[model samples]
Target: MESGKLLKAIIESAIDGIITIDNRGRVESLNPAALKLFGYKLEEVIGRNISVLMPEPDKSSHDGYLHRYQSTGEKRIIGKGREVRGLRKDGSTFPFRLAVSEVQYDDRVIYTGFIHDLSKEKEAEQRLKEYAAELEELVNERTKSLKKMLHALSEAKEEVSLSLLKEKELNQMKSRFVSMASHEFRTPLSSIQLSSVLIEKYAEPFDNPHIKKHVSKIKNAVGNLTTILNDFLSLERLEAGKVEPAFTPFDIVKLSEEVTEEMQMIAKEDQNIIYQHTGIESMVNLDQNLLRNCMINLISNATKYSGEHTFIEFNTEVTDTQCIVTIRDNGIGIPESDQKNLFQAFFRAHNTGNIPGTGLGLNIVQRYAGLMGGELHFESKINEGAIFTLSFKR
Candidate 1:
């Protein structure tokens, strides 16, 4: 009797709802928890069909299922836990987990079912899903904001780079202008001053030869000043897009001879300007003024850089499609490091120390060559010699 009471106490005190049904499917007994879960009184539920506690198809088919199980001993919902819908006394339905077990006492069979309501678990699961979705949306929004910031930073960086490049170009132009003015103006001014002093000294007695020499020096200094002014003016015109090539057919050999003769008068003592023509054609269509300027720049550079008595070779090779002029001199050539910037405005080779120049000559010549659709190239080694070749296509 004591053991039977203990078992009854355990079933009645369980947290989960508990119920037992007889072989006829009538509710034989139920716990207080079961009564509270189903909203039923013990007297009103006892001896009633157990299907009254189930909803829908399970409520209507419970009798047939029990009859089949009793006749065949088949095990469907017996001895297993599964989710099922339960009916309340108020005709409402709710989800629950159920585990059913069968017990045989002598020739009678009984079934016991344990039930647990699942409402809280399902609600908690739905809340977790909502939180995850909100987190994903927040992450996506932050990522888009970050990408926009990066794009803005990239644009800012590009603007800064362009500003820096323009500033550097301006600085270079300013430096070149100052260097060119100081070097070019000083040379002619010095020559004029010395010649004036010499002419004053030779005026009293009037030595004709010495006076003529000083006068010639003064004339040459004036010419140097004129040439410097012309170069600067030409550069300004080229920059302003005002200069245009005037192409005309002219005698290249006669032009070359005349230029060489003029350069020889200013050449160093015992120095010679050698001129040679290899091609048959003497007359060619080209910009005579620009061609003469280029040749003068090259030949003058050679003579200025070389020592006294050095021979300067000027050779012209003519073809059906083009004319090539080569001016070679045995002189102090360009250094390896300075060769690349040879045609930049006011850029002089480091090896040209003590040589008087404005450093704008090669730059002007290069621009003139480009205007005529020609190219200038050179080969040189330090202290050995330099060869400058100018090619003009007809």
Candidate 2:
């Protein structure tokens, strides 16, 4: 009796509710904690159905749930703790966590349910989940903004690098132009001054041949000066965006013939300048002076680099929408590595190291070609010489 009293004391003192149910779903025993937790006394609930302690919807469904489990030999919440609702003696429903255990005692089946108040824990868990979700969204937004800022910073760096490169290129071009003008112009000017002084001092004593030769030399010097000045002026105009090209229709065959004839005097005595027109002639709109300059530069390059006795050929071909003028030279060809920088200003090929040039010739040609809506292209093999093609859009 003393042991029984002590056992009862232990059951009543337990923090968790202790309840035992029989096979018929009727409560067999209810401890003090269970009675107090459900707002019931042992005398009132001991013989009552366990469904009476459950909330309304659960009260109606508990029998079916137990019958299904018994028929199927399946356990639903037998060993699991899940959120549920409990009914107090006052008819108020409160949230709880429930766990059940099944036992066999002397040929009788019994179920013990352990109930825990779940309101505070559930509310805390819900708040934690909400906080985590909000934190994830904030982190994602910050990452997106960081990516955009990085992209913008990358673009700004690229723009700054490009601007610096352009400035460096412009400064280099100015320096080259200044050096070229000083040397090329001063030589010719000095010659003209000396020649004029000699002619004026010995005007009466000089014979016809001597007089004519001096006069011719002066004229040639002046002509060279004028050509240099024109090239420089054209470059300035192009740089200033002041060239309003007057495009007029012109015959391709006629233009080639005239360019070839003009270049005859400059070609080596043993070299031949051939102009071959492939098929019918075509007419295209372009600036005549700009096209002429382009042609002159190409011809001059051919004359300057070709073998003394080799033939330099000029050939033209017309397509549906484009015309190609090809100038072939048999000379020392450009190295493959140097071809990439061929069109750059002041860039000369390794093979033309000994060739005399202002280096502005091809630069002018390329500029004029761009102005006329055309392109200057070339192909070459070492020792086999080169073929420069001017492609003009119709």
Clashes of each: 0, 0
User: Residue 215 of model 2: what lDDT?
Assistant: 51
For all candidates in order, the CA lDDT equals 0.78, 0.73
Off by over 4 Å in 1: 1-205, 208-224
User: What's the lDDT for candidate 2?
Assistant: 0.73
Residue lDDT tens for model 1, 96-157? 88988888866988988889887776665455445434433443453355345435533543
Task: Report per-prediction Cα RMSD to one decimal.
Answer: 36.1, 33.8
Question: How would you encode candidate 2's per-residue C-alpha lDDT over 86-135 as one tens digit per residue?
Answer: 89999988788788888898898888888777667556545544543443
Task: Tell me the TM-score of each prediction against the true structure.
Answer: 0.49, 0.47
Off by over 4 Å in 2: 1-230
State the TM-score for model 1.
0.49
Highest-scoring model, lDDT: 1
